[model samples]
Target: MNENLFAPFITPSIMGITTLPIIIMFPCLILSTPKRWIPNRIQTLQMWLIRLITKQMMTMHNKLGRTWTLMLMSLILFIASTNLLGLLPYSFTPTTQLSMNIGMAIPLWMGTVLMGFRNKPKASLAHFLPQGTPTPLIPMLIIIETISLFIQPLALAVRLTANITAGHLLIHLIGSATLALSSISMTVSSITFMILFLLTILEFAVAMIQAYVFTLLVSLYLHDNS
Candidate 1:
């Protein structure tokens, strides 16, 4: 069965770009929480869930220090799995949509802004502009940094959307061409199918790589703010 198109698989629902951010975030939220409040009923369920996640992470960090080996591996696996799942024949790649990538970037960008403001209330403005710049240079630097802040989310969204959409379109075009030719001769079509199959596998690899890159950039942003 093409699960990608079936009842539980629901291609249209699963294949949009808007879904990735929520999916990726559910886990990240769990990971970022504190431990002590998990048992408190008055606390929101979201809080408890996050606390449980942070507890485990805290344990790991205590044992392993600040090494990102685990976080990196988890991010790669999670994103790769979702991406590859979309590559199945007749399935849609959510990554191909700009909305999904934007969804993913929005939270990250917001987090960066909030963390900068919350952690360094007085320094948030200075963080972007830096200190000790001459009055004449301040306007130029602020303009540049402001532009950069806006571009960060846009760039993140566009990069993933372009890569995934282009890959899928190329794959589908090739498959369609091969299918038309196959009607004329099985031998040529078979070879083309095999080539296309190999390319599909390559697409799986690309999905994982893209996801990793996206997550890594996000982490870097978080680290910078922290």
Candidate 2:
């Protein structure tokens, strides 16, 4: 009912707490785990996607990265599922919220950084300062790198939030225009509807790609740390 572009993003609270918990867990309820060797269609598709994502990470020869395959897989699935489901009429997209995105980003990013430090303290510390740095500029470089390191999680959060929010807004605007036009001119509305249809399809692809990109970057961060 709210005409605000962000109205859908506002999490409803029935008992003081926000609605994301339910929305976040919704996918797991419907999609069963792919545990059986001879799997059903859903399981088969799940396994295929997991394998595809794993193979993509392995392309960088990140054997350590494989250790996080499960976490990474779950992350991708959660994000992808939420994004797609949001496209359905009257559905809310938790990923569109910066707070929600940041919540997901910070923990995962912190875990990867901590893992790297725990596994190899010296090597992890080495990343703070590049080799062959000029002695005079060492302090400046370290400060810059430190800031950049801390910015990783925020960057991840913003990237996902921006893409999802922008795509949804564009789709919403176009859809609204199509509806408004329909009352004025049938011919123009028909053409606009066709455009809206195509845009929706494109938005679907964007939803999936944004999820993949979010997971892929996390993998890369994990790889670097590992």
Candidate number of the best lDDT:
2
Q: Tell me the tens digit of each residue's lDDT in model 2 across 1-226.
A: 5488777778878779877788889977877775767889888887787798878765774667677888888888889889999999989999988998999999999998998999889998888899999899999989999999999999999999999999889888888889999899999999999988998999899988998999998988888888
Judge candidate 2 against the unseen true structure and give its global Cα lDDT, from 0 to 1: 0.87
Which candidate number has the best TM-score? 2
Worst 10 residues of 2 by lDDT: 57-66
lDDT of each: 0.66, 0.87
Model 1 Cα lDDT, one tens digit per residue, 171-225: 8777876988889999999989998889888887888778767766766665555
Task: Give me the displacement of residue 16 in model 1, in angstroms.
Answer: 16
Per-prediction CA RMSD (Å): 9.9, 2.1
